[model samples]
Target: MPGNMVTSEFLVDVDHQRCRRCKRCILNCGFGVFDFQSMTTADSSKCVACHRCVVFCPEEAITIRRNPLAFREHSSWDVDKRKAVWKQAQSPGMILTGMGNDLPWLNVFDHLLIDACQVTNPSIDPLREPMELRTFLGRKPDRVEVVPSDGGYRVQNPPENNIELDIPLIFSGMSYGSVSLNVHKALAIAAEKLGTVMNTGEGGLHQELYPYRDHIIVQCASGRFGVHSDYLNAGVAVEIKIGQGAKPGIGGHLPGEKIGREVSGTRMIPVGTDALSPAPHHDIYSIEDLRQLIYALKEATGYKPISVKIATVHNVAAIASGIARAGADIIYLDGFRGGTGASPAVIRDHVGIPVEIAVAVVDAQLRSEGIRNWVSIIAAGGVRSSADVAKAIALGADAVGVGTAALIAMGCRLCQKCYTGNCSWGIATQKPELVGRLDPDWAAERLVNLVNSWSLELKEVLGALGVNAIESLRGNRERLRSLGLDAATTEIIDVKPAGR
Candidate 1:
């Protein structure tokens, strides 16, 4: 095949002498760019220029350069270069991509600054002083009637005490099949040590991790994979995943190649066929329909609190209010920048709203409707540090979810090669050899360290804001200011500078 004729082919030039046939390039390249046919090394025409092979090569033998002249003379510079070239080739037009969404984001972490106590007011010592990171997730009673007794006033028994976490942050859903068994084990162990929660993404809960059931939050998505009576009642809380921030309208697909014996058994599907999750739940068409499913799950689990997870999209405020009315006790808002195991490049790069705006709007709307206290709001997507957690809470989030940050703490380099199912870091892939590279003991400890570090920072931020507890910071817009915010953002967030 002519090199110019293939739009997907990489423009590669290799120095044969530098290549010792170590095959590290072939193994590390997620797109199958380099292949070994018999004893010779060969490069396929369909390379995406992910640069994994080039970076991993010991001898620096590989060079992948894009053809500058390939662009047509009349083609507009504004058009996507990759898409334009693909159209010229007239081959399969689909854009094959890997990893989560990559777009121009209004990064909440960057926009929102954390308040830290200076020399004026002393900050508490995280090691010695008691700084509470504990957060309550369920609904609080509307009103508590106090009865006068002989000694003092006493209130009736409060709502059933649900699971409590030492910290406000929880591990977001990523799934066993989407990630790896070792990754799941690391999260389970880490959650236990951190005294937090780890979500079993819609993929299904692995029976082996049942020992850490207290720390697990079982997820039920549209596919309902591995969901039975036991799975329903297995976790402290059950989360219903409606839409993910990476690809809101689309559903998940676990390729047949990655579906091993254990995964197949857990999912209760055949090993060699594509596991398809439908775009929408067949039984749920409206908010009322969603209420039915929530009630059904609650009944099956003996009234365990149910959480509804949704992508932070346009009009999220209205949708969140509907979810609150749908009998959900908790609401999880995933921002557009959230990571994914595998998603189309086009979809990942585009679609969905920023978490900062979504959280503000949803919290404001719920408060206006007098239902703000009805449900707890947990924000996810691009939550990097304790500063982010404090900022999110100040923007009206009750808590935050940490995924990419957690993975980075566990040694992920963010190569964005997760879709290929050959992660060198062993966080995204299930291959035994690659998975063995990760040590659960070390990985769990790193995760615990990350959370612990953030907790101290969170306390410092609270102290600077003149607040002792995080609950006081929740939705306290007076403490926040939108630096150089646009009119729309200013109007939405409803915050201005101290002097302005």
Candidate 2:
């Protein structure tokens, strides 16, 4: 066995005689628990018994046995582990974490299915046929009529208009302070290459990324971290992040420890001070207040389209309708199952409604109110595959924002330990060594590959639906059927039986 690092609450035993120090264990362990010393290896005593090292060792030389399992036996399996840990903490009962919203709600990814054409209809060969994934995001005209002008017929533009996207999927908001400059650079490059847009989530824009400003969407959250006149003018559109899917009622805190020199400088805050993003915007207390913020941003940015992002919870449909009438050009809905960088495990594992019900209800309500075209709907939270993207569009989303899926392509293991500021994957933490683990070139390529793959799959699904464009799938709920919906759910979602 290797020498002990400290008094052990948990320990890893490695048989040195059998261990060749091939470093397979070190390479396989997600948590860097083992380090080679002399001719053998030793444990760092931070092991959470993920067992990747023990399972990957070529020889049976490693074992991790916990010391008396600190957790008391629970009669109910419903208790959240992280919440229990928080309860055990001595002080500062706040749950600090990173990444997307984590919750055990009905995952829309699992509930929805993509309709693919079988024998009766032929799937178009993307290589041979033209398939469109273009999406327009903004308010559409309530009604349109062709009129003769001086020369020819023309259609009047609506008070608000849509911004056209080459693809239906967009890069979700991730700030420079929360992520890294290199990560932001990669996202910017990839968005430019893919002809899409990436959101600069609350974090201020870096001057280096200014050249790619045309592909960026700047976000204005409660904190207003990097908001300036020029920064507002930098993006194609502006998004007001009212509430994140994770930690909806709570605020965001980028601990002083994670606020490195670069992040501090970029966010324009003093180093070593916690970046506290308040839960609600002090100025926004109602829909009218929200409209003022929207107009303020629009005026600040010379009338750029403004989007309002909200967490999907109960009463979301009513809230969404109010948002549409609140002068927002677009409405982005984030469901409960979304991933977060760091959130209270308690908040992540509970709180909020599923995306499926939220999207359906909001769409139905908007259509019923004759305001479906008043604002574009962007569905987010736990969108996994191309199938989910297509299904979201079929359910009436103009586009979808994918965060966790994008990070997974960049080598995230979904470890749920990002708040510790020691992420091995380099996707969530601010540590220099952890950030160094990620190669921007490789990570960018992988993100591009993931998006490209999904785009192709989306085209395949559209082709299978006998449609050439993604727009055809929008709000076409007639093609969808509820598999086992209850009365309340069915009524809320307005899902009808097959052949309805």
Candidate 3:
């Protein structure tokens, strides 16, 4: 025992004969749970089960298992529920959690089913036929003007500064402080290669990333951590981040320790100061105020497309309508299950609505209010697979924003230690030693491969749906059927049950 053994939750088992004495486990563990001198786990209570030690131990000497703290089991209060009570009783501290909420909530994508062409309609051959996934995200004029020309009828360009993508996918913003520099570089490189956009989250754009400005989408968060004229102009599009899906109606507090030289320069803040973003924008008192900021950014950025990123809440549809009227070219709706670097457990778990429902509702609202074409919808929050992306498109999203999935492709284990700054994978750490774990060149190509794989799957889904283009799938809710959903859910999502 290493002095403190009062709160031992895990039992340590070591095969002493197989121990290699290489100190690999000791060096790999960010949490000081293992003992070097004894060549075994020292304090089991501190272990978060990151599995770094077990995975890194060369000879497979350590085996850590839960102690299964026995307690009188109750029907209402389970072991986990009782343990939570005990932990809270011990200390009155905020439950700081990382990643998305893990509750087994309803995923609208799972319940909904996609329609495929079997006999009546012929399915398009993706390999032979032209399957266009070219997605244009921005405001569209209600109608385009046409004039007779000498050669033919010439159509005038619509008054919209839209961004066209080879695929309906954009790598969502993850700030520099939350992620490593190489991660941003990887996303930027992949976005350029994939002909899409990568968001330069609230942490600001690094000087080295200026070359990829055309493929970037800069975010102006509530904190405005690194908002500058050049920074805004560098990106082709600017996003006004009102709230994220993980922690809606709550501010963010980046600890002072994570602010290093590079981070400070990028964020334009002192190295030792904590970055505090408030819950609400002081300037945005109402929708009118939001419009003023949107136009102001547009003016500053030479009329670039301005996007408003908001969490999917109960009143998201109405809020999105106001944003469209406010002159925003895009509206990004983040669902409740989105990943975050860190957030208060209560807010992350219980704050917002699922993105699938949000996307459907918001799209329906915009179309019903006769403003569907006014702004493009980018659905986000817990977009895990290509199927999820396809489902999102069928539900009415013009595009989907992927964050956690991209990180996972870059070798993230999803240990959720991002806030602790001990990311061994180098994807989410400010420390130089840990950040060196990721190779930008390899990770960038990996991201490109991931997107390419997803694009292929999207095309397959489209071909099955008897559609030759992504536009046909976008907002085609009639092609979707739900399973195991209540009448209200089906009504709100505007999809009929299976075989109905």
lDDT, candidate 3, 1-500, per-residue tens: 33432355566666779988887777776666778665554577766666777878788888878787776778888666666666676677777878887777887888888889999989988999989999999989898888888979887865568898899999998999989999999999999999999998899999999999989999999899889999999988999999999999888888888899999999999997999999998899799999999999988988999999999999999999999999999999999998898898889999999999999999999999999998999999979888899889889999999999999889887767688888767777898977887898899899999999999998999999999999998988888999998899999989989998
Q: What TM value does model 3 have?
A: 0.94
lDDT of 3: 0.88
Summarize candidate 1's per-residue lDDT along 414-467 as a digit string, tens digits. 657677787766788878777776798888888888888888888877766656
Q: Residue 290 in model 3: shift from native, Å? A: 0.1
lDDT for position 101 in model 3: 78
**Poorest lDDT segment (10 consecutive residues) of candidate 2:** 1-10
lDDT of each: 0.80, 0.79, 0.88
Model 2 sits at a Cα RMSD from the real structure of 4.5
**Top-TM-score structure, candidate number:** 3
* lDDT of model 2, residue 487: 58
User: Which candidate, 1 or 3, has the higher TM-score?
Assistant: 3
Residue 103 accuracy (lDDT) in model 3? 77
Per-candidate TM-scores read: 0.86, 0.87, 0.94
